[model samples]
Target: MIEWFTIVQVSVAVAAGLLCVVLGLAGRKPSDLTMGAAALVEVLLIAQLVIAIASPAFGNEPTGSLLEFYIYLVSAVLLPVAGGFWALIERSRWSTVVLGAVCLAVAVMVYRMNVIWFVQGA
Candidate 1:
C-alpha cells in the first residue's frame, strides 16, 4: 500500500467516526446527511479495495494474507449500509447511536487492516 493512500483512508475513517458520534450524541435521528457521509466513506473504501487489489498487479503487493485483507475490505464496506438500514427501521435517536457504533467499528477495522498490511508487507 502506498503511504499516502493509507493516510487518506485512516483520515476518512476518523472523520466518519467522529461525525457519527457527534450526531448520535446530539440525539439527532438518522438523516440524509449522515447517510450521505456514510455513502461517501463507503465509496472510498471501494476505491481503496480496488487500489489494494490492483497494486499487486503493478508489483506493490502487501505481504499479509490477501484473503484476510479482502475479507476485511468486503465486510467493512457493508457496515455502514447495515447501520443505515437499522436506523431507518428503528426511527429513533438510538439509531444514530447504531450508526455511530458502526462508524467506530469501521475505523478500528481500517486500522487493523493497515497494521496487517504493514506487518506483513514490510
Candidate 2:
C-alpha cells in the first residue's frame, strides 16, 4: 500500500472516531456526514487493497497467501458499510456509538495490515 494513502486512512478514521464520540456524548445520532466519511474510508481501503494486490510490495507473489489477504481486505471494507447501514436504521445516539466502534475497528485493522506487511517483509 502507498504510505501516503495509509496515512490518510488513519487520519480520516481518527477524525471520524472523534466526531462519533462527540456526537454520542451530545446525544445526537450519527449524521449523514459521519456515514459519508465512513464510506469515503471504505473507498480509500479499496484503493489500498488494489495497490497491495498490484504491487505485493513485500516481494512474495500476491497469489500465494490470497486467503489471508482477502480476509483483511474484505472485513476492512465491510465493517464500515455494515456499521453505516445499522446506524441509519437505529436512529439513536447508539448509532453514533456504532460509528465510533467502527472507526476504532478500522484503526485497528489498518495497524494490523501494516504489521502483516512488516512481518512478511522480514
Candidate 3:
C-alpha cells in the first residue's frame, strides 16, 4: 500500500497493457515482446505481494478491510498468469489482445486495492 510504489505499478501496468493492445491491433501475434510485458506486470505484482507482507512490520498496515485488500492483491497477481497461459495456448492476435486486457484489468484492480487500503477504510 505504499503510495509511490503503487503509482509505479499502475504506470507500468498501463504502459505495458497499451503496448500489447497496440501490437495486437496491428495484427501481431503473441511474441516475446507481448509476453515479456505481461511478465513484467507479474513481477511487479509479486513485488507488491512482498511489500504487503512486510509493510505491517514497518507500521504501514492497510487502513481498510484487510481481507478485501488481500483479496484484490491476490486476484490481481493471478490475472497476468492466467492471461499468459491463455495466450500461450492460443497464439493468436486476439490472445495478445487478451493479455493486454488482462494487464489493464490488473492495473484497475491494483488501483482499487490502493483505494481500499487508503481511502475506503477511512
Candidate 4:
C-alpha cells in the first residue's frame, strides 16, 4: 500500500464521518448530502481494494500476513455499504449518525491495515 494514498483515504473518511455526525446531531434526517458523504467513503474503499489487488504486481507487497490484510481491506469496504443501506431503509437521523460512526470505524480499520501492510514485520 502506498503511504500517500492511505493517508488520503484516512483523511477523507475522517472528514466524511465528522460531516455526517455533525449533520445528524443538528437534527437533520438522512439527506443527499449525508448519503453522498457516505458514498464517497465507500468509493475510496473500493479504490483501495483495487490498489491492494494490483500493488503486488508492482512489487509493493505487505510485510505482514496477506490473509490478515485482505480481511481488513474487505471488511473496511463493507462498512459504508451496510451503513448506507441501513440509512436508506430506516430514513432516520440516528441512521445518519450510524453512517458517520461507520465511516469513523472504517478510518481506524484502514489505519490498522496500513500498519499491517507496512509497519508490522518491517
lDDT of each: 0.79, 0.76, 0.93, 0.93
How well does each candidate superpose onto the true structure, as a TM-score? 0.89, 0.83, 0.97, 0.97
Is 1 or 3 the stronger prediction by lDDT?
3
lDDT of 4 by residue, 1-122 (tens): 88999999999999999999999998888999999998999998899999999999999999998899999999999899999999999988899899899999999999999999998984
lDDT of 2: 0.76
lDDT of 2 by residue, 1-122 (tens): 55567778888888887788778878987787778777877888888778887765556354234566668877988988888889888889988888887887887787667656544542
Q: TM-score for model 1? A: 0.89
Clashes of 2: 0
Per-residue lDDT tens digits for candidate 1, residues 75-95, read 998998898889889978788
Q: Give me the runs in candidate 2 sitting further than 4 Å from their true place.
A: 57-66, 120-122
Per-structure clash totals for the candidates: 0, 0, 0, 0
lDDT of 3 at 118: 81
Worst 10 residues of 2 by lDDT: 57-66
